[model samples]
Target chain A: MNEYKILFTGTMGAGKTTAIGSVSEAAPIVTDVANTDLSLGKERTTVGLDFGLLTLASGDRIRLFGTPGQQRFDFLWKILAKSAIGLIILVDNSRSDPLADLVVYLDGFAEDLSVLPCAIGIGRLDTHPVPTLEDYIDILANRNQLVPIMSVDVRRREDVVLLIDTLLAQLEANTFGA
Target chain B: MTILRFGIPHLSDPEVRLVKAFFRLYSQDPTFRWTIVEGPPYDVLLVDESVSEDVVAGTVLTLTPVKSELPNTLERPLRSDHLEAWLKKAEYDLRNARLQPQPPEEQPIDEQRIDPTSSSHFKLRRWPPPALLGSNPVRVRMATLISRRALRLDEMAAITEQPLAECAAVVNLLRGAGLIEIQDLPDKPMTMGRAGGRFADQSVKQSFVSGVRNKLGL
Candidate 1:
């Protein structure tokens, strides 16, 4: 069976770990530590990588890896992203500036994003409705990047799967030059 | 009752009568008071495609797109449902703006007595004030859950199938907005053993599968 490596990256409190855990067949392996960053307002935070596995109906294995959210661990992001078939960038809309947050991920994965199929999952949009989905589309359009973007609650397995399906669909579309 | 003044500029007599007829239907409604005005100081201006630019210098809801996405423009061939929806959104937005925080000294203080020895100075509010609408779905779901019963962030995440981080963000936003009353959980010890934990895991997996099936229509 073929194996596909997928990377999920986002801001510190964007729910990458929960999203991975929600869809993985087995209990996800999480390496979290006591959060010293009080500014993040969370008691515990992912310090290392989170790993999960899902087997598709076609007998393909999908390895899900989540990078630690802090920009300080960006080195690990590249390390984890290596050989990954697709990227899922989660954006927390409730942040001070969500569009700017999206730009950070876009810039961080600049090389991989150019070739690899990528999807953006925006969370908390119901509350932070100012920078609408159209706003994100406009930003991507301005940057000359075309990708599928959707509102997602990562804790839902279906939503997480939808992101993966969207990425795969994009890859399929690109393969056929549709 | 809030009075919303409207100006329909440069329309024929029959068209003006049609607009007035639309307003008359909602005239009996207690919450919305609409007044058809001739000139300035109108709250909203509904202009036809041929209406000149210098008609009024205020909020304009045009029949067609004028220049670069006018905020309140309604497309041609207005529908009652669409008009009602737009007015509701306008009213909601106005209420939200009014509910925004004023200067500290000018802010109204809650009259509820506070316990000085409490760990946190803020008291948990039960019902979200009506002013707290149009928030993110996560926050709205969390509010609904909280309204039903007190819950922790994790519990809220599980119930709503939202990410823990997203749930935490929503909780923080609600707390910061003073729209939620946090109920402290009683300190309890873990009693579930390994076998129980395994069963709980299976249950969670089963529920997740069912949820996915339902969401995907599989």
Candidate 2:
């Protein structure tokens, strides 16, 4: 009962691993390997999963898990979300179809999303602001979702912290008012 | 040049003509080139005082027959001097607003307060950009509550134990930015809502989450 899990899922280059590593107490265990998909221009890719851990003051631990980014491995998304208390969906705005990438994860976790407090972190927005945050909002609103979304640089620990706090704030408020 | 399009939806033909003619010679503000357009998508809208509904457009200027006490209302028999004065003021305000605005002005008490018993719901159309939300964890907490369901301001404040003004500021700020939308509250309240769906097996205690935040220095 001391362990809780949070899931992070997004497109291949959206920084889920970096986000975990940014806040993890110990080195996060990532299952990334040499990328065969060079179109994304990355030497390594997470094929299985990425794991990080945070040990709280009370001896409790929160487990951070990142699901594989490709659609073929979407099956693992639900499995990883099984006991998750929250979800953080990252979107790489610079991608050709970041909106579509978002849909894949949203639909992938639709069930888990129904019960899990979630936040969205859009990366690379400083340079690529076209599919603006407003654009993402339209898509989410159209789908009847009310999840909080914001731009993030997973490389910045503060941004990653803000993203996590966004999710936790959701849970804290709901639990307080539930 | 940014076009400061004005719409005189409720003006008579003669008044519109006169106003348009005057605007043609208004060479004062280089901030924006002003134009008088027919409708919707207006940056400055002049409406009849009789029209009380909110204009989904920019600064609404009401045309009243006599001097009105409320801000932004112009009395009819529109004097060239008065019109010129108001116009110059508006141009300056609009220019500065675009320069970058702080959260919109505070909401009036009635507008900011909501009766828990009322039926209308308020929800966010989008999360406010980080620029607006900026470094305020409490504001983020308020935004999260709002994004989850159509909670009244009182309920939202209570949920987070934040000041009513603080929560109202967040809501109004987003509302001004067009991120918060007003709609009928859903027939069924999202019990335990999407975010708080109690884990089927257990609930994560508040203390546990706080501890994690502390350990990470959040």
Candidate 3:
């Protein structure tokens, strides 16, 4: 079976672990530690990478990895992102400025992003409606970026599947020049 | 059967005949009776948009607000299709308005004091809250955050960086789910820049990433 590597990255408390866990056939392997960063508002945070696995209906195997949310460990982002077919950036809209949060990931993966298919999932939209979908579109437009953006609650298995499906669709569109 | 009335001010004989023909076609549905009244007790007003604002304002002011509902705009040169569409929309709006619950005064008030220990009221405590797992990740996060403390809607909005309306909606959802408590907080100035500078090279990297992702068809 063809194997594809997909990476999920986002801010702390953005539910990267939960998102992967929601869809993984087996329990996700997590590297969580006591969070000293009280500002993140979570007791335990992912210190290392989170890993999960899934088999697509087409018989392709997907290896899902979630990078640590903190930028301090961003060096791992590139290491984990290597050879990945697609990237999913989960933005927590409840943060002070979600668009800015998106910018951070977009910037961190600037190199890999040039050649890799990517999808943006804006979470907490129901809680944070500012910098709306339109605002995100405008921000992406100003930067000359056109990628599929959707409001997602990553905790739901269907939502996580949708993000991945959207990424795959983008890859397919690119292949067929759709 | 519901009855819907239409009124047009200063309508010519030809215009009245056209309107009557449209209503006749409309009446084919048979769910409601359609009629054209000379004045007063009308459910819809077909106002010509081409008329002067002053004239339109005067005519509107003279019309009873409660009696006349769903004021539809009629172009100066009316087409049959346009008139038919407008009448259909107006009829829909009037029917919806009628179906809506009346004001509190119009409703029969149930003022009987409820015994909190009664079976119906007692079921409130027995109701199990919904699992925090759902399609909305923000609500799940908010529920976790608010479980630690009671927060006002705006504070939740600010903390979550979600719109006030969305935050309010989540709050309402959680309240319905019986997961968190909401309390009014004294209005205070929101301090900015707290979330600023948490990460370095955010803007530069974000722009580059966006550009790359855009190029990659992400």
Candidate 4:
């Protein structure tokens, strides 16, 4: 009966919605609308967030929440970020600066939301030659930060499960006194 | 569907408490089927089917064979009709996934709003930057330290040379960032001898339940 809320966030077209649909049992309840922002270079933007519900075999259900990619929607992110047990931060590999995108969410969370459990899923590692997990971890490493850095194909379930499991374990450690 | 086997070399640790993680996430589904196997990764969960295209791309620590596929084993048994039926029910939702619409009042929850109170339930303080040897010196050092041993509060403080409260702060920060884990002592840390021993002992089930409750922040 217990359900953990899992959120997928990152840059535009980082595959957040697809990742949720790939693993969700019930059809993912998505707020995916075409991008209209000029940042998209005249592309469509997701005016709202995407939604998915995944019930693990243990009967534990996790609501997969996806946030809009634009920085302007950062306000909405604070509201959507409530009760999130883990974060699957989808990064766009094709970009020249993926670290900037990572920092965008990292700083956004630190600035806007409550301190909650989270992780980084290096999305689109398959398409672009980004840093390795070890390399990326090095980029995000700090003393107080226990971010689990890994490459993730948003479209895969096993990868999502591993990411979710790692996040859940960390959440448990945080909640249960480790 | 692609089924891959992975080994998590450290599951044997009595304190690792992995089953606690596994059961917490999977115990709800009536039709879920999983088997834990022992191998190089130390633990393997047999997923009956694949979940996404990205599932196959992560580091292939190595693709291990299922127990039934061992060279010396007999032929694999076929699934019975009932077993097949169970798989169908479980697979139906996964295979035929769609997008469900949310009602207007029920807006999707964002993690930032999860804790709106001014008092911080989770507090984090940063550790000293990693030992600078290479480009990502700090991250590498921290990862090595985390994988090697239990990163208790005192040890973290020793490294940062900060006050105990500050040490707790830093640990919480690292915990939030997903860099380390915090483990509570079975009872208050100061308790000793009979006073500590006299604390109400929990039954196995109670202990497990309590442990889970603590982790879930329930």
Candidate 5:
């Protein structure tokens, strides 16, 4: 069977593991551990990448990979993003500087993003809606990349699926003639 | 000699070949300078009901709803007359939209010279933080579609199934909030010759985009 990959990256506590587990047929494999970074305020964090799996109707397989959200793990982002078909960048609006967090990933995966079809999912907009979606668009506009974005609670299986589907819609749109 | 590009998707290889043949054989109208592009950034796309959701701020020549005889519907069988008419219509509508009068009260805010109707593949710079336009179905649909791609004024109305005025309001709302952005650079007038495999297959990339969608029951 054929295999493909999609990478999910975001700040700590932004729910990459939850997003994957919500959609994965089996429990997601996580490298989460007791929080070493106290600034993050979370009890645990993924020290390594998180992994999940899904099987397509054709018997092909899609690998769901999530990068370690801390900025120190930036090197692995490029490595994990390689060979992946697309990227999903999640943002935690509740963070002190969500927009800056988004910029880090946008710049971190800048090379991969140029060629990969990507989507953005904003988490916790319900309680933290300061930097409206429009603010994020402005930053993206400055960079000249038109990425599909929305507010999502990755805990909901449908929400995670929608983020993936949004990326696919863009792919489908481009493949109109192929 | 300015060339306008048009994308005609969902057609089979034979049909594309026939369209190219038709373009070569028929060039009586010098005013119509259109080339066939496969993917996007075309001045217009001839769409059926299929890829309606994928549209972003660009003009599209679509068919009328089942026998309704819409003014600019690119009628079926891909006749030369229909093709010519639609291409002409696409150009004319774009010109017409640009010519739309600016409200006297609103100052001209040029965010890279907003054209509103250019068939460029528009992508959002960011998503809206909240729906200030309220939660009406039409407004919700407008937000969803616009967030995906920039819409031609008519496409905003057509795809959302709302009045043109309402769609414009949604765009204006987003524009007011600084949520809009033109994904492709504004068009520039350029010359081109129509000969020797002139119609270019630039792209169309969603290979199995629907795979995950199907598996997820979307």
Candidate 6:
């Protein structure tokens, strides 16, 4: 059995760590630190990376790598995106502009992950007054080509699993040329 | 019909696959009664091994039957040598059956040998607090060194209070991102450089101070 590597990349505080912890069967090994960086005025921060190992029921283990979202550490994201089989671009809707956040990450992918399969998770939309999924998709459509995008609570098990399943299906479709 | 029972730890994938294969192959025999008993937070395999005592303490192997006779009591100790021989033959296949982690610091026996509670001088004031952030070393480094203009890996080790390897790992990550520029002042005596050097920017200093404040709640 072969295991695939998946990556979770998004803005800071977008729940990358929470998502990994919720879905990972093993206690997710976390690399987190309180945000002290004044670069983006971040009060809470994840400077290095959040990595977790997930064992699927098929007995194949998939490694989930969560990269930092700050523009200063763009180098790390590029390196991590090289071997990434799929990308989970988490969007924070509670922030003023979801579309702007989407643009930043999508632009980053333009360099390293050209044509890589991506699934956008619109986080914090449940509490915030944000547009619906259709609105979110339309928001993405104006930018460039649209990928499989959905609103997800990164903290929930089912939502994270659904996002991964989408990514796996996309990978299979790509690999088999289906 | 020699029916023997086994108590097994968590079954590995390879072990389960092998068992299923053997079960399917032996299902053709009418006298064989291989039963799987799952109960009480443990899994047991009931096999009719002719050579009962042959099975080792930590293995699952196929047993060949020499006769057909169910022992009246099911709690009989496994005394089958025939099964043990089979285990020896299949031991290679089971090598990767379980995935064990790299040896932990302080082996189980070592932890047991040292009674932390009993050592009055060494007694921990508190269990180490839950990490405020996850175990990302780079973040820890940036969090720690963000305020400092210049930091040696040795200085980082001292600041984080972690071992050299951990400190090196954190520094390497920060250096990779161009967030830090490492200068090797090998000739510097006593590993002493000033704390919070002038090289750090106001932003980096503020970030570092905030991080320390958040972490220490000072």
**Top candidate (DockQ):** 2
Model 6: per-residue Cα lDDT over A79-116, one tens digit each: 87776667899888877777788888888887644446
Best-to-worst order by TM-score is: 2, 5, 1, 3, 4, 6
- For candidate 3, the docking band is incorrect
The reply for model 3, stretches above 4 Å from the true place, is A56-60, B1-218
Query: Cα deviation in Å at residue B149, candidate 2?
Result: 3.2
lDDT of 6 by residue, B1-218 (tens): 22222333234555444444444334334443332222221113333344355433333433233432433212222333433334333333333432344378734423432221221111111111012112233332323232223444444444445675665444433332222332433334223222222213434323333332232222
Model 4 compared with the native: what TM-score?
Answer: 0.46
Complex DockQ per candidate:
0.02, 0.25, 0.03, 0.02, 0.11, 0.03
Task: Estimate every model's Cα lDDT from 0 to 1.
Answer: 0.63, 0.74, 0.59, 0.47, 0.67, 0.50
Which is better, 2 or 6, measured by TM-score? 2
Tens digits of per-residue lDDT for model 4, B64-149: 23334432121223223422343344345433431355576654323322222212223222222211112232232233333333
- DockQ of predicted model 5: 0.11
Off by over 4 Å in 5: B1-207
Candidate number with greatest lDDT: 2
On DockQ, the stronger of 1 and 2 is 2
**Candidate 4 Cα outliers beyond 4 Å, as residue runs:** A1-3, A37-44, A56-60, A111-115, A142-144, A175-178, B1-218
Residue B125 of model 6 has an lDDT of 12
TM-score of chain A of 6: 0.87
lDDT of 4 at A42: 31
Give the CAPRI class of candidate 2: acceptable
Stretches of model 6 off by over 4 angstroms after superposition: A1-3, A37-43, A56-59, A112-114, A176-178, B1-218
TM-score of each: 0.48, 0.68, 0.46, 0.46, 0.55, 0.42
By lDDT: ranked, best first: 2, 5, 1, 3, 6, 4
lDDT tens digits, residues A79-157, model 2?
8887787899999999999999889888999987776889999999879866767568668877978788888899888
